[model samples]
Target: MSEGYQIRNQSAPHFLTFTVVDWVDVFTRKSCRDIVIESLKFCQKNKGMEIYGYVIMSNHIHMIIQSNDGNLSNLIKDFKSFVAKQILEEIESGGESRADWMLKRFEFAAQSNSRNSKYQFWRYGNHPEEVSSEKFLWTKLNYIHMNPVRAGIVNKASDYLYSSAANYVGGEGLIEFELPSNPIIDVLRKERFNFEIDEW
Candidate 1:
């Protein structure tokens, strides 16, 4: 991996954007989205990853993640590997008839990379941006929440089913997420943010 793609300072929280190979809209398919969800749940159960926020877009995933054990890179690697294997298996079993086409497209993308094997589900670069400032954190948060809106998938961010917006908006049920400790929270308090579902 190039130095630019390496996850530096694993002890600190970071904002990560992972794109699918060739920017394919894989998450548009429910099966692909489920594979991601399952992989995330598996990480939460087994890894020391603390997922503060996330948004699952058609072609990529945006996340604010930190590792308690200082192994954030490993967590991301495992999550991607697990999801890729499951999705590939599903495709091989003919679970999704369209997967054959998708796999062929992914193979074409992998050919450009000598490092990849037969398939490359996600691009190699995770593009981890360390979140050392509060402003950057909020910027990343808004960017993630607005991704579905930018795609015209939903009028409101909280309406998107595959994001943590609902959780931040005081919704009862959704993907279980770990809220990170922010210095801003200490100054403003949770009431100041007033995360309401209708705010979107």
Candidate 2:
């Protein structure tokens, strides 16, 4: 992981990516995807996670998020830990047809990381990029929403059931999230009519 990608401002919003080990398409199964969704909901409710936007792809997830309690790194660490165990258990229970093959890969991935006891599901590093400016924020949000479209999984971003694009378009999303306001304007208002791009 590069130093630039490390989470610095723990309370600030960041664009994050969570990829499966070996880029495995674990989320092709709705059951697997649902586990991630429910886990994120749990974090939001109990861990002070504030999700700005997100999309779940076949092998990875992209999210715009922040920690309300200013402990983003710990919050993410716990989220990944819980979700990894739940999904591994689901696969071990024969919920997936490719369970054996997937488990072998996960086990192999775990061999390199001292943090794992049996399997490794998520890859190391979140690739977190702080949401530094209004332009950068919307750029990441657009990229997240357009993932399914770029992959041809959906013709329109809003048509994807596992993304916040639906909520962006005034439809309901599977998980709750806050619609982001322009960071520049929000900063300006909060600072009594003064704003610096870096202050975001």
Query: Top TM-score: which candidate number?
Result: 2
In model 2, which runs have C-alpha deviations exceeding 4 angstroms?
183-200
Expressed as tens digits, the lDDT of each residue in 61-127 for candidate 2 is 9998999999999999999899888998899898789999999999999999797888889888889
User: What's the TM-score of every candidate structure?
Assistant: 0.86, 0.89
Tens-digit lDDT string for candidate 1 (1-200): 45875677997889888888878787888888888877777777789777778889988999888887898888888888888888788778877767778899878887998978898888877889888888678768767887888889898788888888777666532578756555674333235445443655
Clashes of each: 0, 0
TM-score of 1: 0.86
lDDT of 1: 0.78
Identify the leading candidate in terms of lDDT: 2
RMSD, each candidate, Å?
3.4, 6.8
Question: Model 2 TM-score?
Answer: 0.89
* Candidate models: Cα lDDT each: 0.78, 0.85
